[model samples]
Target: MNWEQALGSKAELINTALDLLLPRASAYPSPIHEAMRYSTLAGGKRLRGAFVIAVADILGTDGERVLPAAAALEMIHTYSLIHDDLPAMDDDDYRRGKPTCHKVYGEAVAILAGDALLTLAFCTLSRLQEKGFEPGVVLRVIQEVGKAAGSQGLIGGQAVDLDSEGVKVSKETLEYIHNHKTGALFSASVRCGALLSGAGDEELQALSEYAKGFGLAFQITDDLLDLTGDQELLGKKPGSDLAKNKATFPGILGIGEAIKLAEDQVKKCQLSIARFGPRADFLRGAANYLLTRKR
Candidate 1:
């Protein structure tokens, strides 16, 4: 599928949508706008947005109909990364190959930038209704996305991750951390696409399974990357995950075992989409890409 090329195209679509949804650069005469722009435009793979758009494509819907929600998901994801790299969290010095927001804009500004991006996410979604999508579907997307990004989902996972750092934890606890911290957003992205496309309950369930598997697989691959990826390749240091004492798949299982686990999850994700036939190709492709990702 030439995943590198495909991923580039997907990333372009996501960036375009984000540009369309961003508040006007001069909307508020504030420095926070620059900070927000710095963080948002620093650039990542935009995998979450790609997943949302791909799911919409699978449902035979146009990307335009789902672009706002997809961009919103990217904004939320970017906000999480911003907060996660704070001095209180990972204390990361660099992100996406550039100095972090706090490093460039100061801590207070960085925090406000994260807050602005987060609130902007909902604002983007709220505008979707004006784009002519079904009102009921838009409402459902908002609700699902809110819950996923809230205390019960990403935030909860982050809490668990913070508490578990440097503490011995069971495999189950590790699962909880990864599922909540990483899986919830994945679940939301897929669910949002399904809801937007009017997918039935059965299809939604299948997509949810696919997302869960992808979530875990994504984290596992990220851990693997931290172990083996070059700083230049990853836009961050290798072995940072272990150096930070972050809980990770490799921390729980040896690297060999972690790779096996990731492979298994990829299979599970592919199986989840089997019933959808050719329409599920992108989902399958995405799962495979996760397994093979170096950065």
Candidate 2:
């Protein structure tokens, strides 16, 4: 199957896995449960979880074994988005074409929702460890994800991004911001997947490079979208990044150059996995999809 078809197929499996892992309808207090489900059930590409499952599949691991880790990845990703949209961060009013959690549920509830999601992610992972994973494997996954989600990775990148607001920054600084803020999680997604499936050192290193290149490409495309995308296509304000004077890839590299850069990055990402055979098709498909995504 082609990239589009492959991604569609993988998405189905990922969604099914998520359904198996999500909290039941009765797991939370009334309105809070509604709010939690509202954000969790809201449509997303489910890319991180898919990455985990795909990599596990590539390494000949069972899908069921990877489900808990995949669910944890999604919870962490959702929590990040929730916090990212808060007033102190991006302050976005719309996400995935609907009112943001804070806008719909009020800030306090939104904060609580984000907190709950974050804790829930760890709880899910801990449960997996309790089931039967080797303590070493669980420790590695937790350390990798914690670093990715914490100050050294996404959070650090966000800090730099916020600090660079309304100011000129060098290209290196901009790249660092994009790499940490977004690339870290992307890298962790692949690493966590590979680790869960027992991939070796060399294969893990290769997938890490693939994830890094793809993550940067993803960010570059997002920057380009912010500059030239329509609000209708983007599902949110298109020019907010530019209006806020944030330094973006296009801001530093020019639109044409930025597109070229993303394409090059995608090519490198694909090259990193050419040896993995048919099992690596999903990774290649995801890279291609990232290049062509409208939102």
Candidate 3:
């Protein structure tokens, strides 16, 4: 299959796993569950989840063996989005072409929904043991995901991002925000699959480097899209970054320079896994796909 077709298949697999893992909307305390489903089931690229599956595939494991990890990563991603759209956060009204979780469910329910999803992500990770993975491997995956989502990773990056808004920050600071906020989970997603598939330390390290470059490139392209993309294509209004006075690649480095940097990162991402030869073609395609993505 081609890249888009492959990505779509992975997304479908993840969506199916998520549908099974999440509580039904009719379950007790339905509002929060409903809210969680509302944002998550609403469509997006599912890139992080796909990364988990793709890495597992490249490492000679059946992608289905890591479905729980893929689903858990997507859940964590959705939870982050829900929280990121809150009034005190980015204050976004729309995401994935629909009203954001907070707008649809009210702030209280939205907050609880994000919390529930985050908790459920760990719960999902723990189930890997039941799926015949080693307890130690499962535990490592859980810890990796927790650290990525916790104060030292996503949260820390967000704190710095919030603090840096509308300020003249150094490129070093901006890189820190992107690496931690966006790149940490990306790295973890890659690592989870590698850890599950019994990849060697060198292999894991190479994939981590690939993810770092891919994540930065993805963020740069996203920033560019926010500046120049159409709302219909983006699934949300453009220029939200500008409105928030957020630090962005284009903002710091000029549009042409930012594009060049994104291209450089994509090349680095490709080279990082070149040692794997054709086994890693999908990942190289995925990194290239970042540049051309409209949403």
Comparison by TM-score, 1 against 2, better one: 1
Model 1: per-residue lDDT, tens digit, 1-295? 6666776888898887777666656778567887887788778888788778888888888877788888899999989988998999889988888888899989998898889899999988988788788788788889999999989999999999999888888889888888989999999998888888888889999999999999999988888899888898788778877887888888889899999999999999988999899887778888998877767
Q: What is the TM-score of each candidate against the true structure?
A: 0.96, 0.94, 0.99
Give the top-scoring candidate (TM-score).
3
Q: What's the candidate order when arranged by decreasing TM-score?
A: 3, 1, 2
The regions of model 2 sitting more than 4 angstroms off are 16-28, 130-132
Locate the minimum summed-lDDT window of 10 residues in model 1: 21-30
lDDT for residue 225 in candidate 2, whole number 0-100: 88
Choose the strongest candidate by lDDT: 3
Against the true structure, candidate 1 has what lDDT?
0.87
Q: Candidate 2 at residue 81, lDDT?
A: 84
- Taking all chains together, the TM-score of candidate 3 against the true structure is 0.99
Decide which is better by TM-score, 2 or 3: 3
The model with the greater TM-score, 1 or 3, is 3
Going through the candidates in the order shown, the clash numbers are 0, 0, 0
lDDT by residue (139-162, candidate 3, tens digit) is 999999999999899999999999
